[model samples]
Target: MDFTSEKKEAENNKNTTNGNNPQEIVDSSSQLSVADGNNSISKEADEFRERQARDLKAGLHPLKSKFVFWYTRRTPGVRNQTSYEDNIKKIVDFSTVEGFWVCYCHLARPSSLPIPTDLHLFKEGIRPLWEDSANCNGGKWIIRFKKVVSGRFWEDLVLALVGDQLDYGENICGAVLSIRFNEDILSVWNRNASDNQAVMALRDSIKRHLKLPHSYVMEYKPHNASLRDNSSYRNTWLRG
Candidate 1:
């Protein structure tokens, strides 16, 4: 079975809508004041993002956090690729929006990647491993999509994550995009799994940011569960 043909057919489905809109995610609440320093922070977050966008507009873009991008691919005939960690390579670290876009433009999009490839965009200090101390207590929210829409979905979510539009308030660690044969899974990792409030907030924010309908489903899985399974991509526990 030539999955690439299936991928092309999937791309033609056109279920993915145009969602690169920032205003759709960040609302007028972004204008609220932070007088007591405890007021609604959606405004502050919006302000911060506006500033960042302005910086990017002026060719001076910088983000609140530094992020490292990693790439992993399974080679068909390469004996050098032994383990998941073996094929993984740290690509580049970007702190600015311009810098990220430069890399993004040069790299292949999710739809262009071969099956079994994965991309990791984690905070500079945190590796994308589930066992990493920074992620040990955290969990991931997985959004699965068909190849047709997954590429756009991945890009929009990455922008939101880096822009801090999700507004989980620093509870987020980073995000991962896993490309597979039948589908692609985009998951956001946070710092605390037990923090149900934070998890749900982030989940809802993702749905809102992507402007997804109520019927869409997002899956949550703890890092601890991944440890026992030995593979982040399959066979573990699922929390709604």
Candidate 2:
């Protein structure tokens, strides 16, 4: 769809609330605190790593790199970075195909998630925030899909990411599935927004992997722009 059509769809869905408000930003410091805490989280990480090593030794297919699944549910009125970080939780990380499915199967699908919730699958060391060193100079390509097809689309993108199907896979940092009242958003983030060749290649890879139609609208938003505006989905440049 064109920008005008996409805008209209967004407006139409504005009143279709899922008993939730909009989302908030995230913080990196809070993530560090969680890692430093002396709790089950630390124990869980140690056990997870041990199991991952065992799986690899047992011949589980290893992925190009490790990835972490992050989850965050935003309060209706809290929008600051600190609150966002506090809300963000590290779900789990996986380094093998089998490990990925083990984690994915236990989680609720995007369609079942409440509004204003986000499921972020990023590289092990990269936080979902725009301020992350790997993401600070980069941007994301976002595609909004109807709620009915959102789950399938999200799974497709996740598989493509872990399966190394993207031509510019090295440039990709991660993908996010944002569950909202209006629509579900799927975004692929890259490491360098200034590399036009890599950016366009990543976009093309998404289209090919998702088999999106010619008229489907996609958006590009630089991390710097999000940092300046304190918004993730606003002021995006439309592309298809």
Candidate 3:
């Protein structure tokens, strides 16, 4: 999952698919911005549309839905919404396969990201915030993995998401990769916590796509529980 190899492969694929020079791909990292509340979301949506239009003209294959990448460096002891909002920064938004690779190639690998850092990939217009209307009634399924395998798992999850490999993809809102001191955690967010069938289907789909071993335990926690406890990874229901 290193950038050099992935970039080369993507470049080759682009050349084969549309006969366009790889140089046409823009570096999306330069577009990173910190959200200034509601206004930022509105502005981002407009920008996303404009960018997608240009990419379409370039012959890139469009994805079913657009997605935004977000990064945040947590303050060790701070857990409030105000502080969290301040730390989160929007990296870029992509609506096509080529755009996704352009963004992904520039991102630091999950294993290399510093402790207390989080990388989020969410559907466009859906902020990663639990308070977002799209997420308020939802929950997430989290899987913890050793640091060494973080990159592979994160990439697999991203591919499955954008490729629409999941049966319950409509229920999915986004995903997060948290790099911590000892382990990396991956969480997939859904739009409805009350939809048991959809939630379980999402979990199954994730396991299948990731080829997750049965030995690994998965935990599900409602956003309401996180709001009450002010913790993202506490008091969860576990499935082995």
Candidate 4:
């Protein structure tokens, strides 16, 4: 329809592609480039050693342990936002142990990011949006965290997801942190909404790892429900 509009929207994505600024240096990849000129040999050896150590520490299925990182700014409707699909492809292309940490280091924490924006990390081949074939018929188990408690909760949740701690880890498509003024929300998407067994398993896994108190409650809602009316889902699932 509007090719010009799409072109302008694509240009706005410059910052997204140029990610990893203000480097946090969390992985060997970032360090390798710095070993320029004379010290390249030593740097290569050090990097090799670091990689071996990482491989040793990697738990079962090291390859699957890797997660893709996606960032969004606090903007309405993601309107005027960067090319999301393109950015996701970029992530998949560059995904590696080093790239994951580098991307994380550069991006703002969910709590620190402006409102309405989100940071999503899903297994490779899985898009963050619910529309992906992997997610189309699925749903998410959402846990709400107050703004004051969001930072550590977010970190723990990320670790839990990437570390493959969820009960139905294979069913887990990805996780999302939706920022809001009052309370931040974390939703772990599963591949099938109708799979009661898998859904229950995932919910229990989250509660166990997160160690939610007896007073706390988690809600599961279908993506279709979310798209139709988030409030209806919340009301039916949430209890005081």
Candidate 5:
């Protein structure tokens, strides 16, 4: 709740509704147990969160997995002489909930991001591309929400993921969110395209965390198909 240092630093860039401190964007929606306060974190949550309080008192919070966040934006009437990967920026990697918040707080929010921009948070060392070995055998579950409502869903999904609340073990690769001109899209990526049990569990976890009914529909797509057709967002496969 206190970002005095961030407030002072962001004062010069005070263009956002939160008055320049990007950290404020997550205040209403931060789902990380470390951010949600002690009482709100149930004992059944991930072990990372179980230890977050003690770690925080010692100025550190360790997590079971590491994640890297990336950002990219498309510009109109601008032909950049650089590869798409070259344009993509690797924001930072976090091995703890607190560290994740520190990096995320300074980044632009999905609602305020430029049109045609994506926010990718993947397991450390795994590039957010289908071609990566870690993702080649994986697929993502795409969910759609209005731009204004997507932020909260995005928050919960990321927390459930990094916190290992999905109970999928290491099968989860990462998640991505696309902020487009029309609507927003959020996807949960897992390392397996054929593990029905694990995949179903992840799907159900997502639904439960977002408090959606079992009938709330979403589609799963394999990276192999994307590689075959050179598409990223296309979901020809479906899984309930």
Candidate 6:
């Protein structure tokens, strides 16, 4: 039979199989219709979303996954005091998640270093320099870890930054791990020096998370002065 003839025969058979009432057949078919099907699917989607939200509220830590960018200055060239800085621009372009671990794994640990060097973990657009737009008006909270403890301390601090264990992350521009002869340091860079609330909140959060010792002192300094500008506010800051 032709397409139309076949379709007609099928409908006739369907009605006959039912009560032979066309309206009853239509009503029965309407219950299984695409529009109702779509409504059920939409309801299921909403329920699934609600359940997920509830689970998240019930202390289910949200899975956080994202690219992290880091810069290390302890490369052999910098350690040798070659009077030259690494090509900063090239490092910025190299910032990425996988690149971060690859860079960390291939580099010397902080304890093995003989000079003061810094590893900067910041968002891709941001440069680690104090004068960069994101850093210009910022400050950092300094954490001094003894040189002998550099290995464990460095690993912990780096993990904190990468895993976003710090508070006020929106105001956080980056973090730095500075390797010195007698001490290793970790510092948190904030986007605004005037954001006292965010800065303090971030400090408190970190201290609580790490259960830092009561004697540990954290110092805050604007990035420009940290870069060793003689005339910056930090100079006046120290005198005060």
lDDT of 4 by residue, 1-240 (tens): 112233344334333444342222122233211337459647645765665567657631133444676654444444321454443322332223334343444455555566765667787667776568789899888788888887777777776776667787878888888777778888888898998888888888888888787777688888777656633136434332
Least well predicted 10-residue stretch by lDDT in candidate 5 = 17-26
- The local distance difference test score of model 1 is 0.70
Model-by-model lDDT, in order? Answer: 0.70, 0.77, 0.79, 0.62, 0.70, 0.55
Which model scores highest in lDDT?
3
Candidate 3 residue runs with Cα over 4 Å from true position = 1-57, 238-240
Misplaced by over 4 Å in model 4 are: 1-61, 77-102, 230-240
lDDT of 3 by residue, 14-121 (tens): 423221111212233333224566887688667768877877799876777889888888888777799899878777777777667766665666766667888899
Residue-wise C-alpha lDDT for candidate 6, range 1-240, written one tens digit per residue: 012223344443332231221121123342111449789659756765765576567643221222233444344433222232342312222222332343334334556544645556675456666777778898777777887875776666655665567787667776667776667777777899877788788888777766778888777777767666532223323100
Error of 3 at 149 (Å): 0.8
Q: Model 1, residue 176: displacement in angstroms? A: 0.9
Please report the TM-score between candidate 5 and the true structure.
0.72
> Which residue segments of model 1 deviate by more than 4 Å?
1-59, 75-82, 233-240
Report the C-alpha lDDT of model 2 over 176-201, residue by residue, as the tens digit.
99888888899999999999999888
CA error at residue 98 for candidate 5, angstroms: 2.0
Taking every candidate in turn, the Cα RMSD to the unseen true structure, in Å, is: 12.7, 12.0, 7.2, 14.1, 9.7, 23.6
Q: Please give me the total number of clashing residue pairs in predicted model 4.
A: 0
lDDT of 3 at 22: 18
Across 1-240, the per-residue lDDT of candidate 5 in tens digits comes to: 232344353444323322222232233433321345564335335655655665777776567777888766656444343555666666667676556556565565677777787788888778887777778888988887888888888877777777777768588888989887788988888899999888888887788888865655788889899778766677559856
lDDT of 4: 0.62
Q: What local lDDT score does residue 40 receive in model 6, on the 0 to 100 scale?
A: 68
The predicted structure with the larger TM-score, 5 or 6, is 5
Task: Compute the lDDT for candidate 2.
Answer: 0.77
Error of 6 at 1 (Å): 64
